[model samples]
Target: MSFIGIKKNITQKDTAEKYIGDVSTYISNNYSNNIKVHDIAKYVNITGAYLFRLFKEYLHTSPQQFLINFRMEKACELLKDCNFTTGQLARSIGYRDVLLFSKIFKKSFGISPSDYRKQL
Candidate 1:
């Protein structure tokens, strides 16, 4: 009696896989902009709540955490160019707040952006 034929048709594993793929693609494609969970979920025709649940159940993390890690990873790669300042790098990875970017960056790498560039 379900709209999608049956409730059993949509297993957690299937939903998790679909969510992961959609989120990964959306982030990879729009990491330079202000992306959000609601936007990605809407794009994939799913509810934001479902996206959060799938991310927590399968990935063991929230969408926001995943996005932060993804952005930090991208920022590290971009750092190799040695042409961007902390603010520039932060903005480059879709973060407008340099303080927040520095906090997240230190949390991920155990070093501040200035210290990171000094090491390079």
Candidate 2:
């Protein structure tokens, strides 16, 4: 068989799993920055459409949702410490608008940042 055919012998499921892992790692490492699906797709040597489809199929989440969830989780962790203001915390977690961050935070945890900190 030719090289192309040989390479094609690899299962699509395996390739999708590997790509999803790579994208997950990329999101984990860069969650503090504004990352887009196209950027991740480029990093993994795939097209944006393919990346989206793979993420949806394997992770049941879009890349953007994954990033937002990651950021919110990080924000919750940081909220335990009282060093940063809400704005600073939001910015640190890749949110430029504190109000928007608060909205997302409230939606994710069902409480405001200040209240969450108070509980800690």
Candidate 3:
């Protein structure tokens, strides 16, 4: 490729990386809120479909999956150190329904959050 073509490729790669980083940072900063894929796309100035593609290409996961994983990871950290009830823990991690949160926790870690805490 020509120098100009190489430069363009680098710039495109950089922009793609920046968008992914922006999405990740936004999720990390707002995982405690009831945020959605559309909200995240808006924050990053992209369409939701594009956001999905970006995450799928770069992270090998859907954006929604990434968000869920992020929330679950954060929940694990909080559960380790905080004396939060299940409901409180759910809300703290952006889950309004304790049952749903528990379900996801069980799916992710093969145990309920309470059980996970008990083990901890």
Which candidate has the highest lDDT of all?
Answer: 3
lDDT of 1 by residue, 13-76 (tens): 6867976997899889998898887888888889988888888888899988899999988888
> Which candidate, 1 or 3, has the higher TM-score?
3
lDDT of each: 0.86, 0.86, 0.93
TM-score of each: 0.84, 0.83, 0.94
Candidate 3 minimal-lDDT segment of 10 residues: 50-59
Name the candidate that leads on TM-score.
3
**Residue 49 miss distance in model 1 (angstroms):** 1.5
The superposed Cα distance between candidate 2 and the true structure at residue 60, in angstroms, equals 1.2
TM-score of 1: 0.84
Worst 10 residues of 2 by lDDT: 4-13
Give the candidate order by descending TM-score: 3, 1, 2
Task: List ranges where model 1 is wrong by over 4 Å.
Answer: 1-11
Residue 99 lDDT (model 3) = 93
**What tens-digit string does per-residue lDDT give for candidate 2 at 1-120?**
988777775677789989988988998888778677778899999998888898788889887788789898899889876479999999898788899999999998899999999988
